[model samples]
Target: MPATAIDIGTYAVKVISADPGKQPNIIRTVETLNPHGIAMPIDDLQIEQVGELVNNIVFDNKIPHADIRLSLPESIVSSKVISIPPLTDAELASAINWQAEQHIPIPKEDLSLQYKVLYRPEKSKQEQMRVLLIGTRKSLVDRFINMFIAMGIEPTLLETHVLSLLRSLDIGADEPPTMVLNIGATNMDVVVIFKGEIQFVFTHSGAGALLTKTLQQTLGLDLQQAEQYKRTYGLDPNQFEGRVRNALIPVINTLTNEIQKAQRYFASQFPQNTLSRIVITGGTSQLPGLVEYLSESLGTEILFSAPFASATGEIPQENQQTYSVCLGLLMRELA
Candidate 1:
């Protein structure tokens, strides 16, 4: 069977259809500007409108709607790793629900929780295991479900943006601890992965739209021209006589500050493991000079993620970075 994945990012709606088996073949990919509403919706009417846009994109692309997969951005969900005292499998099951109450902000009833035991501590005095807790608002889940129902289709899988973005990478388990920064339109999600385990997930409001808006205000340019200048001369010192770069520097600095905080937190948690690489993905990640800016700011190797890095054949690279979550969703079934 073939599966289709959709990620409704604020700036674009990204789609990927693949044939599912041992090796999923890339069938088609679609990217469309989210004309319904550029800003992500919080209310029902807006969600409904976006849902229609999603449906129309799929239908317009002539992609298969069955075996559908979806990804929700970091803004709407909570991901936390909690430590628990040693207990039996059955006991741990009971413990996580209680742990969710303590760690996740969503109420017990409104929360939909998922967990995985990452790894147990060494032969130490206070022996305990760490668990990854992923919780989403039930109403949010309901919103996605109802939105799909309006299209007469049900999604087979749903995941957070960070998880799906990580899945799209070719990161190796033997590799050193790495930081993945998803600079999406609405939110910036920083994830620390060590030995294939999630060490930390942090979501921040410092993101692409902020940079664009900063340029808009500082350069006294309209929204479209500001965005154009941003994409053209992003942090490129020589491009705009340092005027555009000057306006964007503060915003980029603030975002890098959050990344540095993640680095410190990762170092504190895993004293032995140092973050060696930083992977930048999402639409805005490709802004000119942005990668160089991050590399210089963080003093680490920075890599841009392409959607089909692991897949062979005629896979186009246009919009590759922004389609991370959607491609990873297809792989959730295909790979």
Candidate 2:
């Protein structure tokens, strides 16, 4: 049996088994419900339901005592990829602390910092490691830590949604710099990778909800109808396509601009880097014609990321393509 990591996402609670070489079996996954019949936003859920959902998933799955890999919301954590001369683990830890102070707006004393070393190839004395340093308010970190402790589980690795999403992309050793985009309920996390390492990541609010709101406003449709239209007609301008393209232009423009900015900065730093492909994941990534629209707009080949690349013949092929992040959490141990 593999160790388990439970990801408490904004939209749902996902319990993933950390099997490394095997698929991260979905021990349990459930969307929290509001008793009042009004679907409360993730942030507005009562505190008890958060714990209840987690506990129920763990119990229902008969999962106990696995190394948990929980995700901190993008708003709670700060992420930056910094390059530094290769050093001993001790030196890296100290350097990351100083680097965190420079990049993170919060005072160092108020936050807990962690770093993941991305690329430090063996060979040269001048080789540097591209490190992803994450900083979160001490209080917030404590709350999550305590939440697991209260449930009798201790997380071995606590990461942000961006890290988990990037982990899901299955970047191969021979692959070139690629862009990974994850569109969630209310936020989108974009990470730029080169040579199987992350160079930059940015999180943006307004993902599916924005599209739904646009449809609701422009077409005078309810939320469910708008969502259905978005899934069916995304960015298409045909008669059945509705006005989604016009409504989503602003949001897509903003997303494209952010990607452009990251690409520009990445190019200036690594002039020789070649971008190979763009990977899109998450629920909204399933939007019809969205990939083609992005390809035309961004001028790059687009691919939908399937997170089960590392797993063997465990999960059925059909469901493997979806649940990339939940599966990636389980595969992190393998990586």
Candidate 3:
């Protein structure tokens, strides 16, 4: 069955549909954003505005009874890396639920959790397997369902942002272990993938908004001006200084610290595994000198995401970068 893709985040929701054919067909690709003005105060009016914007995109595009593959934002999802004895499908499912009950804080009834087995090297015993499990609050899940239903769509599949981003990279089933970082408005999520299996996932409290606030307070600029400055200066010592640089220091330090911790943990656990690359994604990833900074700090090869890494269709080159997750969702759903 073909898949429609919908990625709903705090800042925006993107929808794309692909049809089944010899060559991948793009049925529709549309996106709508929550106005930047409403980022600080998410109120009834802002919610209504977002609903209207979503409605307009669907109506204008004439997406009829679409079947969507949805992605949850990192802010609202819980995930972990766990090693379990390999088992049959039924046993794996049961084990995952039991594990979630033990590890996830929410009551079993209030959360929806699922897991996928990770790829392992051929030399390892088949029974020693790694898995990625994710849990989302039922309340949050229902809200997204309601919003999409109101727009005349029903999701056939639902997953987290990390999965979608990995799909965008087309990391092969046997590829080396790698890490991906998504820098969004509200938070930064670091995901570790070893030999195509997600080994760990963690989120940082501050992200793009933190930097924006730093600029606003230190430079006495408004949100828009601060955001512009961040994109312009972005860890570059020469371009920004004084309080501006000082304010950014905390967030940058925190970001690097998390990466170091993740790397160390992966190393200690999987002594033979090597982290060959790092991929950066999301809006804040456009920061002027972030790639260089992260590489220098982490001492690894850093790759900026080109969202359309493995899909077909001629999107304008400019939009191709950020829409990678949305496109990946479409490809996964329809392929």
Candidate 4:
């Protein structure tokens, strides 16, 4: 049975259901924006509203009430790649718990931990396995699970957005090391993948919302008008005699600086791997000239995310980037 994949973002909720077999036709894609002035689901009222919206989508679309695969914002999850001495399955379980204590700041009792061995030497006698550790606050997990349960849906899998994005893109082992920048409304998620494995994941507060705020404060436009201007003249100095561009340049510079820092850090850790390309996603990534600007600033080939490359669907061109996370979650469920 096909599973429903939902990405509940700060500004919008995107849901996609697809038949994973036979070219993966997308059954439906539902996107609903939050009400004015409500940025994220920070309170019970907003959460309840989101649940209702999802329930309506399921009912209207006749979506099966089965196990749903969900993707959480990167802000709620902490992921790291660590090395450990190769051990048997039983020993690995114990070792991961011990290692989690040192790496995860939350108390073990308050966190839900998951791990996967990304690489293990086949013939080396003194090789260590690289393991990916994901830790989430148990309460947050439970809340989302319960929310789904309330709507008669089972939460089968919950993954961070970065992993889902990587899976959706289906970066191949033959491809060079690549970086993905997901600029959401409230935060930005940066991920580095090499040889089909995730090397780094980081989330920060500088993203679309910052740019919106800057425009609103500088131009005295309302939230809606500021957002319109952002999409219309983002980083394009030719617009409004460069007034909008000027308002946005500071934030863009800061974002690029952070990306450079991340690139440098990754290079320091893995000198053998050179980043070949950068893929930008999220709703904000659609801003005019963002691709060209980022390419010029980072001095790397920059591309927009196209998550539907392997899936045959009638998705709108404007919505492809916004639905990258949702499509990735569907891909994960199908896999």
The 0-to-1 C-alpha lDDT of every candidate, in the order given, reads: 0.82, 0.69, 0.72, 0.82
What candidate 1 gets wrong by more than 4 Å, as runs, is: 21-23, 38-40, 121-126
Tell me each candidate's TM-score.
0.94, 0.83, 0.86, 0.93
Model 3: runs farther than 4 Å from truth?
Answer: 1-4, 20-31, 36-49, 61-65, 119-127, 240-246
Select the stronger candidate by lDDT from 1 and 3: 1
lDDT (Cα, tens digit) per residue for candidate 3, span 131-164? 7778888866776666667666676777788877
lDDT of candidate model 4 versus the reference: 0.82
Task: Give the per-residue lDDT of model 1 (tens digit) for 124-221.
Answer: 55787888899988887887787788788888888888877877885767888888888888788888888888888989986788888999888899
Clashes of each: 0, 0, 2, 0
Q: On residues 1-335, what C-alpha lDDT tens digit does candidate 4 reach at each position?
A: 77778887777877888765324678777787755324334468866877787777778878755858888787888888888878777888878888998888778889899898888777656788788889988887787778778888888788888878887788888999899999988888988888888887888887888899899999999999999999899988888899998999889898899899989988998998789799999988888888898899889999988888878766655568888877777766444
lDDT of 4 at 320: 84
List ranges where model 4 is wrong by over 4 Å.
21-23, 36-43, 333-335
> Cα miss at 19, model 4 (Å)?
0.8
Expressed as tens digits, the lDDT of each residue in 186-283 for candidate 2 is: 77888887777787887887777787788899889997798778777888788464577777777777777877777778789888875657888877
TM-score of 4: 0.93
